[model samples]
Target: MRTHFCGELNKKNLDQDVTLCGWVNRRRDHGGVIFLDIRDKKGLAQVVINPETIDTFKLAETIRNEFVLKITGKVIARDNEMINNKISTGEIEVLANHIEILNASKPIPFQLDSMETSEEVRLKYRYLDLRREEMQKRLRLRSKVTHFMRDFMDKNDFLDIETPFLTKATPEGARDYLVPSRTHEGGFFALPQSPQLFKQLLMMSGFERYYQIVKCFRDEDLRADRQPEFTQLDVETSFMNEDEITSLMENMIRGLFKDLGDIDLPNEFPTITYHNAIKLYGVDRPDMRIPLQMVDVNEIMEKVEFKVFSGPANSENGRVAALKVPGGASISRKQIDDYTKFVSIYGAKGLAYIKINDDGPSSPIIKFLGDEVTQKVIDLTGAKTGDIIFFGADKSKIVNEALGSLREKLGNDLKLFNKEWAPIWVVDFPMFDEADDGTFNAIHHPFTAPSVSTEALLDNPGKSLSRAYDLVINGSEVGGGSIRIHQSDMQKTVLKLLGIGDEEAREKFGFLLDALDYGCPPHGGIAFGLDRLVMTLSKTESIRDVIAFPKTQTAACLLTDAPSSVSKSQLKELNIKVTLPTKN
Candidate 1:
């Protein structure tokens, strides 16, 4: 329908005729000489209809924002005064010789250039919203990134294999979106939360290497980076260890960055133990770009007279950690109050601080602590003359979360972070953690294999460590994976330790257990969240911007208004009933 794209017109095509079809981005009629900014997916081009072409000029006046049109014109250099330095096609304009109204559009619901529109409104009008330049660029970049990954994997002999979307529900780390079977009456199928199980089965089937850009679903709560349905670059391999797989994936990421641009990524990714990450940063996913780290102050606090600090320090499940905010002595009282409220959202009872003034700890709580205790805090934190320290003391979980999150906040507030990137592998995670009810649950999943040395601890259970690793970038968990137990006995033991009895394990994962018995190869893989990864590479903070279409925080599709009720007949066919919760 068109000979050239809007962005393709330049000085080289100054006298050539071109046919272009796109929407009118803007229209201006200056004393009957009509001008239109024609836009397509590529970019914008100016089309001029002079007074000599009176009929076309009159027709252009009907074209408002978003009116689709096709024009045949001769490209000509724009007068110096009319040149636009912002675009590549800035040097020239097309003088319209022929014009046709391909389609017409009503006034759009929202402006394309405004970033202040509500996400709901933008999503509802997503087709128009995607026409915006930024959205188009982001989607294009995503495509390029996927292409790069695929090429890199293919060159390494990884097969682009697909796994099932509708499969058995094997509790693959998230709640599956189940599909009811009308034919089978009571049977149901589930959307995969990942290709975790199927990818492993592929290894058993003798595929040495595999990769897939696949969609996964989960019936889970939403976060800035999470959605009910998401995409992942699922990968798996047979007979590869932790370091081998990690190095291969790390090299792939570096190659991708280099191919896209000469972006200098670290030659080698750093490694950290899960235990050390929690103790130093208060969170396993710590932002290496941020120089600040948490310091243990429980010993110093235990010696103080302040009960607020001493109480938790003496308790079994409690901890006291401080995040030293560099040059934060000038922080206002209001800012501290704001930070207190921020931590409260994460279930913290209160936020404590000891602002180091010109002399020493100057807060009111400083009076309760003796000189020795105050000096210990300063020494332990390595606090300089201009630093202020914030403390979180509570149960271990609360202390980690509050203090961990405070580090992120202080980085932004005090501007103590660089824009540089850092990727690391957090290895040797606990295989299981005891819940409040004393039941043990898999920290990663039941399928994750424990280190051979820790296989004995499976009998003790509380001390077992898994051969799991997470690829963390700037504190975000971009990907996670583990080596699988190819042996049936080891798999059974690990499942048993996770509180899943043999009978239950057989009922849910009997097929996998049976497969292991038949001689499954030693296998492991990683699944990178495609959305989070692309967003990280693009330096976009919100994952939603990377997705072509994404739902709101409430998990409703504004464009389609999905999850709406269906007819009673539909429910009857699936042998299901819709019930509403009773008002208490």
Candidate 2:
């Protein structure tokens, strides 16, 4: 409908006649002349209808903000003082000769350029919200990211194959979104949490390498970075070990960051084990940007007179760890008390601290710890004159989680981050995590291949390690994968370890087991949360900003009023009967 985009006209188009069809961003009147700023998907262009263009100027006077209009004009240079330095097409303006109000709009709920709009109002009118330049650039960058991924995978000889959206439900550490089977009574198909099993099956089907930009669903509670439905860049390949796969994927990520933001990643990403990451940083996905580490002081505190330290120090499942915050003597008492409450979220009974003042180590617990053990702690943590050591003495789990997370918090609070981009691979995860009930649960998934054989894993599940790896950038876990068990017997062994018996395994994953028997190759792959990745790259705090029509925190669509109830007739047609429990 137009010869040139609103943003496409600059000095190069001066004196050339052009037509633009867009929404009028604003209408201004200076005496008899009318100025209209027209906007399209590209951007905005100022159009002036002076008194000389009598009919056009008359129509332009009736234009308002958001009025859709088709304008025929000649691009002309703006006065030196009138030029806008902020916009790309600021060097010139268009002099309108003809103007047509294609569509008129009522007063908008809120101005698009205003930043004071609430999230609820913005989401309710998301179409208008997306018209803002920020949203346009974000979604456009998302498209470019996906396109680059496809091109990279294709060049690597990876097939862009697809997997099913509806499949059998299996335990993937999250509740499945189940779809009722209208034709088959009570039967249901669960939306995939990830194309995990099917992608593994594809490897057994002899596709050497594969990748898919697929949608995934999980019936989990929502968070800032989570939604009911999200997109994943799923990948699987045969004959490639974790090293080969991670290396290639790392290259793709490096190229992506460099291409999109001109940000150069490190030449090589560092690697850490799951055990060490938890010990040092308290989380499996550690944020390496933080220049902090938790130190063990259990051995030194074991014989201390203070039972608070010695009690947990001597126990099998307890720990006494110290987080040394360099130059931390500056922290006020109220801040320390605030931190005490912060760690309580992870089950910490209390937070103990000693300030290394010029006078000597000082703390309320120092008297109970005695001069000897207190001095030893100072020496153990390499406490300097201005350093402050925070202690966590509780069950090992509680201590690690509290202290580890606190270290990251302090890093941010103290502005101790050493770099902006820190990528690392966390590998050598345990095959299973032991439950208090003496049961075994796969750390990643039941299908993840253990570094040890089935017999060794059965003999000692805790000692067994998986060939799994996770890609962490900044603080977010962007992608994770593991080698799959190619042997049917091994697959059955792991499933049985997970309490899924032969019958149950066959029922839930019979197709995958059958494929394994036909000859599966040693395979491994990773899946990246595409939204989380874009959120990371865009430096946006919320995932909703990266999504077009995201749900609210409660997972309801404000724009469409989705998750709405169906009519009784439609339910009857699906052979379903409605039942409701009486409200309390």
Candidate 3:
């Protein structure tokens, strides 16, 4: 319908005849002349019609915002004083010789540029929402990101492969979205949480390098960065060890951020052990941008008479830690109370603080903790005048979560960050985590190979570490992976430790076990959460902002009205009966 995009015209094309197709962005009447700003996917262009062109001018007067138009015009330079410096076609405008209205739009539900539009309304009218400049730009950048990744993988000799979406169900932490089979009564196919086993099988099938920009599903609770179904840049390779794989992936991220985001991410990301990450920052995905860190005060608090601090300090699973915020003595009592309420969300009873005022350390709890212990804390945390030391005394997990989360909050609120961008590699994760009942759960997944051998892992499962690594950027776990067990025996041994009996193991993962027996290579790989990656790059808090169409937090698609009921005949064909549950 047009010879050129509305945005593609400029001073270089001045005096040339052009036909453009787009929606009317804005319409105005300037004296006797009519002006319309037309917008397309590329951008907007201003079109002018003079009284001299009586027919076109009259047509322009009828055009309103969002009316689709096809215009044939002569590109002419705008008077230099009249140029709009804000837009791409600001220096020039189209002098309309002819105009055609393709479609007319009624008043929109909300203005395209309105910032106060509710998410519910925006998502419901996602088509109109996508027409906005920000949404179009985000989706376009998302396409470029995927293309860059595909190009990088291809250049690195990674085969872009596909895996089955409808695969067998197996325990992989999250619940699966099941699809019923018509041919076999009661049979179901589960949507993949990932192509975990299938990718491993490909290694056994001898595709040394493989990658896929694939979809994965998980029937789990949603978050700002989670959805029922999500995209990942799935990757796997054989022969290469942890360092080789991590370095290559790091380079990809570094280059992507530098080129696409215009941010110079760290050339060599710092490495931290899983244990140290928890000890220092409380979370596995630590935001190193935050200068705040947790200090172990367990030793100093152990002998104190204050039961709140000493009791947990002496317990095996307990901890007493401090976070020193520089120049935070200015913090008000009300703000401290607010922080106390915040920490309580993580199971902390309260937040304790010692402010280094002009005179000396001051706090109501100062009397309970004697001068000696208080002085030690002041020295350990290097608390000077104008500093405040916040304390968390509870079970280690509670202490870590409360203080760790508080640290990040304070970093943002108090502006304590040392830098804008921080990326790190969290390595040496435990092979398994111990439950309260002394049972074991895979730290990453069942297939993750331990850094130690089968005999060694069996002897000390709690102490065993995995050859796992996670790529964390600014506190988000963008990607994670671990070496896979190549030998069938090792896989079985690890599975047994998790209380999966022999028969159940055979029933659930017999195919994987059977495949492993047939020459599975020593391989490892990571899957990058593409939505979360884009969310970070786009500087958006919610992954949905970057995703074209995302479900709500309740996992419902309001636009499509999905998860709807099936017809009786359809259900009968599948040999299924509806069973509505009774409300409590």
Q: Write the per-residue lDDT of candidate 3 for residues 495-548, one digit (tens) a residue.
A: 999999889999999999999877778999999999989988888889999988
Model 3's C-alpha root-mean-square deviation from the true structure amounts to: 1.4
Please identify model 2 stretches exceeding 4 Å from their true place: 29-33
Residue-by-residue lDDT tens digits, candidate 2, 126-178: 99999898898899989999999999999999999888987889999899998
- Between which residue pairs do clashes occur in model 3? none
In model 1, which residue pairs have backbone atoms overlapping below 3 Å? none
Q: Give all TM-scores, in the order shown.
A: 0.97, 0.95, 0.98
Instruction: Give the clash count for each candidate.
Output: 0, 0, 0
lDDT of 3 at 13: 94
lDDT for each residue of candidate 1 in 44-157, tens digit (9 for 90 to 100): 999999878888876876789899999999999999998999998999999998899988898889988887998878989889889989889889989998999999999999
Off by over 4 Å in 1: 453-455, 582-584
Tell me how candidate 2 scores on lDDT.
0.91
Whole-model Cα lDDT of every candidate shown, in order: 0.87, 0.91, 0.93
Give the higher-TM-score candidate: 1 or 2.
1
